[model samples]
Target: MNKRVLRIYFLISIVGLLAVYFFWPKYEKLPILETVSSFQLENVHGGTYSLNNEKIKLVTFFYTHCPDICPMTMMDLMKLQAQLQKEGIFGNKVELVAISLDPENDTPKVIKRYSEGFSADPLGWKWLRGSEGDTKEIANSLKMQYQKLEGDFFSHSTTMFLLDDENNIRALYDMAISDNPIDTTKILEDISILIEGY
Candidate 1:
């Protein structure tokens, strides 16, 4: 090539390099909040459940008889389950767990029925229940709060947590903290980012 052509090509290469360096999209990873210990809970199927060091977990709390928010949260998660399966990350890289706050009423049978009402897949999603103290302990560790109301309803924090394979608390998405609720897309995006990290 001629000297003029070579010089133009060199300038173009430098410009391309600069563009890539300055303009390429970057994904900021979700922040790790704290390390989580594997706590045991009972799945609706009468099997033991824990956050094993193998999959990313989307953990939330709910009760079978919750008037509104709990059901809304699980419905949102059912949508999320579909999205995760469509993305081919449902079982391999991601799992969902909804722990019951009212274990006394949310027996395995009740929770199983609840899980079925939403078409929750047992392989990808699990509805869990533990003793009242254990459930409270897990909630407290995730910085969630709950109270039993006089009307047999529980007022609780609707905070969703993301945990890595090692059971570390990676990120929290509080559905109650926002005037505009956090949509499922954003939650899936965060999960995608976390999965990509692994």
Candidate 2:
């Protein structure tokens, strides 16, 4: 090609490389929801909670009627809980809060029953809910979008976010695909890393 064209191409290549290098996705998050309000909800066990004062926790969203996707996601969460329990903070510092997407149907009673089905322990895990508007606002803030399907079903992403003691979303665990479940091992690794960092 011509000299001018070659120089332009080289400049573009350098710019592209710089963009890719600088704009790459970060492996470690720097507290995205740094100042989000401390959310309040009623637990299936009939207790009140706010994320601000809660311990280090795993938080996920699901509905009682979600047959395929949510159930799988819950199983993965349970596995992570189990792993955490085996390591000993199952009761002291670790908590799993699964918020309901279907607030209309997932009342305190329904959430309690659902938690039972998932082998949820009241001391460690919670099936939580709030008003429809309240849930929508919280989900929007977290970027956990969902849409109602036919027969009042729902389609939503299967992501469990880990929150530290400060209520920041420390890690996002995407567990929709079967081949790649939430990395409990990595999550635990991060928890330790963060704890050390603090």
Q: Model 2: per-residue lDDT, tens digit, 1-198? A: 999999999999999999988898645644655435688998778769778765787788988888777777777777877887888877578788888999898878877877777777777787788998999998887888889888979988777787887777777888656656667788888776566554
Q: Which 10 successive residues of model 2 have the least lDDT summed?
A: 26-35
Alpha carbon lDDT of residue 7, candidate 1?
Answer: 100
**Number of the top-ranking candidate, with lDDT as the measure:** 1
Off by over 4 Å in 2: 1-33
lDDT of 1: 0.83
Candidate 1, residues 115-151: lDDT per residue as tens digits? 9988899998988888999988888888889998886
Error of 2 at 47 (Å): 1.7
